[model samples]
Target chain A: MSVAGLYNYWIVILLMMTGFYVVISSGNLVKKIIGLNLFQASVFILYISMGKVADGGAPILREGITHYSNPLPHVLILTAIVVGVATTALGLALVVRIREAYGSVEEDDIHRQDESL
Target chain B: MIGTQLPALQVVVPLLAAPLCLALHRPFATWALTLTASALSMLVSILLLGQVLAQGVIDYAFGGWAAPFGIAYRVDLANAYVLLIVTTISTVVTIFARRSVASEVEAHNQGLFYTAWLLCLTGLLGITITGDAFNLFVFLEISSLSSYVLIAMGTERKALTAAYQYLIMGTIGATFILIGIGLLYMLTGTLNMLDMAHRLITVADSRTARTGFAFLTVGLGLKIALFPLHLWLPNAYAHAPSAVSAFLAATATKVAVYVLLRFVFSVFGVDFALGTMPLALGLAVLGTIAVLSASTVAIFQHNLKRMLAYSSVAQVGYLALGVSLATPAGLTATLLHLFNHALMKGTLFLALGCIAWRLGSVRLGDLKGLGYRMPWTMGVFVLGGLSLIGLPLTAGFISKWYLVLAALERGWWPVILVIIAGSLLAVIYIWRVIETAYLSKTNKTAGAGEAPLSMLLPAWLLAIANLYFGMHTGLSAGIATQAAAALFGIQP
Candidate 1:
């Protein structure tokens, strides 16, 4: 119930909203991809945050630290990060093709061209 | 070890085959690999379904770690059923793809097309079979990324734009889903769905759990293309290579709906989802809108593929409406439709692919008087159309019958009226194509011919399946009832 315990989650939410807002409001295709990257990165932070143990060390298999960070979330987030990167690459490639085809990366311009067609 | 290995093989077989398909670098060899991989996956899924059916639920812990601590693959009736749908569609589509891809895609890229097709198959099956929420997100991306490539492989220039639009929208949806999974993990500290479900029940009244639910619903709703979220669907389906459209329209959104169902019924618990929240009303309202709006829109489309795509949205509404009913009967209807619609739509799209292959376009005008030239193909189209319109003796009618009964059981007469109205709209659009193909005068300038036997076989196989299942309700309805009962936490 303490304010201190909820700080990490609040930051995660803030980051998520910022990315979502950019994706929704931006007209530029590159900016949308960046927003998507930020959005996925924020989720990565959330997953990592959940893995934290009180006074825990990194999730290494060494002998010293008694409290190990949750390895499951770390593993899950690794897969997610891979997916995020793949999506980003695909999005950027699509943007490049769009630029070539439509001569603009702006959403409105693309739509206008499509309408004219 | 073999028991432990089954889950990994279910996904890995298809995954490995995809790259091998590319390595083969010949259309014939690639097709063989793709078909073998899909067929093997289908066999595995059937076996897994039988195992799960007998043993209640089988949870395979990954890397030798237990639940709440490790990733797991949980196979229950629900996922097993979805796995069956994904693999079955992949198998049929692969057979259908042989001739269709030969005609639609470049000969050199046929290998690449098969590679992507196998990868897409792997992703869909993985999404259905995986128990870990994050793994679901990963598989979702895999399927989605390949789908964009597959859609872009169409011969039309418009296919690139359609793929681009779908890429943008699909990424947004995946991001939302990832965020939802992140929120759930933050709140419950678990990635395993069963573990998360147990934890969620403890924190059911918390704001975090409620927020997570909202994110998950919206994210999955986007994937399912629920009404307003369906803007990207029509273009993608219309422009994608005909085989890709058939496979995707039949399988992709259905799997998304399965994910939504899993999260709602299994992870969130029925009490919180159905009793405490307005989810039922929301689903019912949006579903009704999708049915009426999309069907109405479908009637106006000149392109047969685009028309069926819109109709797919309308059919999706019926599935959602079934879920909203929140009864065993209702869920049964939803599951039945999920299977039946896949058969019907898969057939419809395959028929369109045949038309596209022979006529070079599926425009209603282009189809004029072609029924005589391609009797078998047109016959398949008409049969699929009959199913789409929910006529009495087709697979579509069985689901609609059950859905209507479910609505009546809930005293939702208005929903019954909506279903009937939607079916009527379906008839109009289907009749448009029928009239164009049969009644209109033929043009001497347009040379029409029948599709190759490879295409006709898969199309007719599904068309006949439409009739076969319609008559013999025991298999589809029986399994669906058991699956739905299991979903509702009821024992058969």
Candidate 2:
């Protein structure tokens, strides 16, 4: 395969590394969650891209359609999407609790407060 | 009629009860529902193990869909062993949770707390029982999200931050695993683990397959809290309420270890993972480091709960060391320690729950002269502590004895030395509690007395189990050896 054939994978890697960098570098709690979302989104894209077939129509079989993209990855990603949403909601709920308990969502502030205790 | 449905029911019992628990407003009602679910699951797990030993691996296809197309639940000896461990610990901790949760958690929130705990149990058992790779990831997230909720419900404010940090770390780990599974699905075009393993053979030498393995290893290494990726463990264990601590500490990581072994030896095949990849030496080196560093760190902690948390990490190191050996004997040792560590840590954490119930603190300073005030409670603590240190005639020593035997067979002299050093470190940390409780002046008791019979009975159940299993190794060690041989695809 030519380098041009791997375009989606390059984008996947780029988005993944960028999101991972934000998650690791950002001290703000909400920002880290956003980065985690981005990281997961890249994986969704990777999965979706892998399921495509050249010149394929929708997975729904029709008269005269000789090819179709795999639908299993789509189905799998839907479940992953649901799990990702649940994780985000739970994470944000914890962030709300953190803000209430430590009076700030900044990592440094929470650490100092816990240390003082 | 229900005999054949054991695999699905092992998880569904807890999954269905979680929502019912959330609906029940009374704390006691929710606790009863959760206990009922775990007890049923434990019974099913025992039957499943017996069935597995009798019939070999049992495959249950969902919705009547066969494997390679529909999701399946396969109960081999290994799955039954892990399922039994998770269900057993969950059942014991559910029994231990009534008073612990009432005192530690707010009354209004107890229903929701038990709901999350039930979901966590569903997830851990589901992960161990499923034969589908994608299904395992879903269950992993289920357990992790519920654990975050459970951890955030701790008594101290720091629990909030601990849950938040774990959420971040755990989510990243889960996503990495999702990517790995997706890659495997792309190459094999099937999600069934056995089918994937069969398909993976011809493609196993590919770079993509190798990348998938690396990703899976790192993700699971995070889940296992292996040495480098272990920062999230101590705080998560230390800050959670004691019942949650006991249950999660006992089951979650052990389940993760089972998954790791399954993916490595079963899915990837031992040749691709350990033989081709140099994984044996890498895991051995990291396991050694984790044992040395985590054990040394445990001795310096002032909080007894946090100290035990670090010890949990070191115990995980022993499991990894056993896996690194890549022999049937080594795996048997790992399996034995998996159960033994759960016994010791479960007892220790439950005992700490009792201490926190009475004294309202678990710091080293609060333990001063506590032996005289709560003799039975402190006696349980001392026995748990001795087991943690792997003293003779205890469950902990039985596993360590096997671990040393394995190392000696492998001619890993340095690992043997590390094991000795790790045990010495455990003695120092455990003896600190004993010395503080018995030898100190009697000014720091806080006027507390023995915990309720309800709590003491459950702690002693596990403590006595530790001694019983230690003396009669036939059941624990015998089954572990059989399961280990099966995993290695050899005759016991």
Candidate 3:
């Protein structure tokens, strides 16, 4: 495949890897959650891109339309977006609790505190 | 009508009850509703299992939209067994939760706890039963979200960190699964598992399909607690409320395994997924390391709950081992272990919950001489521990025997040695607890009595099940073999 042809997938992979790295390497609890959201967003982009067809419009009933983007991935990603929102809300809530308990959200601080315990 | 709707009702009951539980501010009423809903789902699972056995796979399409267009709840021999395991454990844990939750959670938060518990159950059951790949992701998120909440509710503040860690790992896993499913949909243009299976056979060698398979395995590996990706499990289990730990230990990973089985054998075809790739051998190596390393680490844990949590990761290794064998006997052993391990771990965790109920801690030091103080509870723990050690006349032995037999069939004698060594490690860790509880002298100052009957009954119920299923393997082994055969495309 040409670079132009595969550029979309390349972007998706790059975004996903960056998000995964941020999650694994970040000490800040909130940063890790943001990384998670980024990772999921990359997946959403990949699905939506795959759904697209050349010169296609929204998947709706049109008399003159010959091609339409695949709608299934869009529907599936809609559900996934909701799941992502729920996860973010829950993650933030946990971070709040962690901050309250440890007085810090950094992984290093939590570890140090726990070790002292 | 009820029989016809059993598959949908199996998950829907708990799903609906979760909202009801949250809305009902009365703590007692919520607990009662959660318990009743769990029991009802368990009954539905039993009926579903019977129907699957007698009539074979039951396919129920949502809104009568038919497969490939709408989602389907497909109950074959495999997932029916899983559904039974999930619901049975949930029922037992719910029965035990009333007293345990009352003690661990603040009175006002009790309703929310029960709500999350039921939602988790619904998510697990839904993941086990759905035939649509996308539906599986939705259900996975439901269960995972609820689990984070449940773990966060632990009495200890550490539970928050554990819950956060789990949320991060679980979301990553779910995202990878979603990516895999999306790739498969792109390749096959179908989301229904059976349709995907049919479509995939033609393009099994395609690069996209191969990439999708890899993504699915790694993604699920994280969720299934497969060795290296299992860092989240120990803390999550060690710090969650006892009832949540028992419930999750007994059910969540088992359902994840069910999903792995569906993808490997049904969607991707074993020959292409395992045979073409070295996936089986790779999994076998990872499983061996998981078993050996986790068991060894478990031996050094000062906290009893953490030790058991490590042991759980080791147990997951055994499941992965069975999957790696990639034969009917191997699959059978995996399925049997799935059921057996749930019984052993459920019983052991519940017993610990009993101790936690009476003493407010499960530290090894705190448990000294509990043999005299809580003889019945400790006795149940002993039986459960023996099962964990794979001793004769316990549930653990039955699955271990099958695993050994499967390894021998493949002439993989080193795996047999690995299994034996793993058990020896289990013996050491389990014996540590026994030594602490039975051999050490009791601290007479703190007047701790036996755990209440409500707690004792459920723990013993599972303990007895461990022994009974070991002695009488007809049900578990029979269905497991049938499920394996079905996976291999054998009609019988």
Candidate 4:
């Protein structure tokens, strides 16, 4: 494939690595979740990009449309999006509880407190 | 009529019951519902196994839509065997949970606790049964999400962080899986496992397929708590409510192993996974390292739960060892250990739950003379520990026997030595607890007699099953032999 044709995949690689790096590098609990979200969003983009045909219309039969993008991936990813939202919500809720329990959301602070306990 | 619907009802019964648990809002009512749902699925799994044995594989499409398009729940001997193990553990755990949950969890959260338990059961059972690759991912999340809720309900303030840690790791693992599936879908344009397998043959050497395989392995390795990726487990297990720890320890990672077996053999084919790849060698080497390192780590831990959690990782190494051999006899060892490990660990963890019930802690230092005071609980603890150490005539010995024989058949003497060393390490850790409880002196648990007969009954039931199934290997080993042979397309 040409460079232009591979543009979307390059974006996917960049986004995935960026998100992954932040997840491992950040000490703040909320930032990790955000990093996770960004990581997932890259895959969502990958799926959406792969499903697209260069000149295809939406996957609905029309009078003159000859090409159509795949709809299955979009539908599959919708379920994933819901799952992703649920994960973020639960993650944030846990963060709230962690803050209430430990008085801090930084990973190091929580560990230090636990050590003293 | 219901016989044909067994596959659907296997998951639907618990999935539907989960919501009612939240609506009921009373602890007793929800516990009853949880028990009922677990028991019903246990029955369905048994019937499914019987049907699979008598007939052939039972493939049921959801809503009457056929496969390669609509989702399918395919039950062969392997899937049925895993279902049987999972549902049975969930049922026993539910029985043990009544009193455990009452004392450990807050009364207000008890209903939601059972709700999450039922949903977790749904997710586990669904993962075992689904033939659609994407549907398996959905069920994986269902279980993962509920387990996070279940773990967070731990009384310790640290439970929050454990759950948080597991959430981050588990989600990354799941997303890796999703990406792997997405890559495979791009190549095959099919989500049905069997169809993907059939098409994967043509593109088995493609770089994309290999990358997909890597993602799947790493993601699953994390879920299975393979040695290096096992960071979340000890804290998660150690901090979880005893019942939650017991339940997850018995079912979750075992189900993950089942998925790995399914994908490697059924979907990827032995040729693709082992022939082209150095998977067998890699697994064998890593399994060796895991067994030695995790067992050594387990030996030094003071907390019983944390020790056992690390031991669980080592036990997973044994399973990986068995799978690495990649022969029919070898897989029999894997499957047999998979079932027997559940029985033994379920007994051990449940017994620990009882001890924790009285003393409110699982520190090895806490209970010195409790073996005399709580004879039955401690007696069973010894029994489960014996099995954990692979004592002769115990269930662990049976599987380890087969694992060694499988290795000997390959003339892999070093692997056999590692297996023995792993068992010896188990003895040291287990003996440490036994010596502390029986050999040391303390009146700490003076008034704490035995746990209620209600809870002891279930723990004893699992412990006794160790002896029963250990002596009689027809049910566990028989099905495993057939499944393993079937995987290699060999005559049994």
Which is the better candidate, 1 or 4, if ranked by DockQ? 4
The C-alpha lDDT values of all candidates are: 0.89, 0.92, 0.93, 0.93
Query: DockQ of each model against the real complex?
Result: 0.59, 0.94, 0.94, 0.91
What tens digits encode model 4's per-residue C-alpha lDDT throughout B406-479?
Answer: 99998899999999999999999999999988999885644688898878999999999999888999999999
| Candidate 1 wrong stretches, greater than 4 Å | A1-11, A61-65, B1-5
Q: Answer with 1 or 3, whichever has the higher DockQ.
A: 3
**Interface alpha-carbon RMSD, every candidate:** 1.8, 0.7, 0.6, 0.4
The true-versus-predicted C-alpha distance at residue B36 of model 2, in Å, is: 0.8
Q: Is candidate 1 or candidate 2 better by lDDT?
A: 2
Model 2 Cα shift for residue B220 (angstroms) = 0.4
lDDT of 1 by residue, B294-396 (tens): 9999999988899999999999899999999999999999999999999999999999999988988999888888888899999999999999899998999
The TM-score, computed over Cα atoms with residue i paired to residue i, of candidate 2 is: 0.99
lDDT of 2 at A33: 93
Chain B TM-scores, listed for every candidate in order, come to 0.98, 0.99, 0.99, 0.99
Candidate 4 A-chain TM? Answer: 0.96
TM-scores of the candidates in the order shown: 0.95, 0.99, 0.99, 0.99
Which residue pairs in candidate 1 have backbone atoms (N, alpha carbon, C) closer than 3 angstroms, thus clashing? Answer: none
Which runs in model 2 stand beyond 4 Å of their true positions?
B444-446
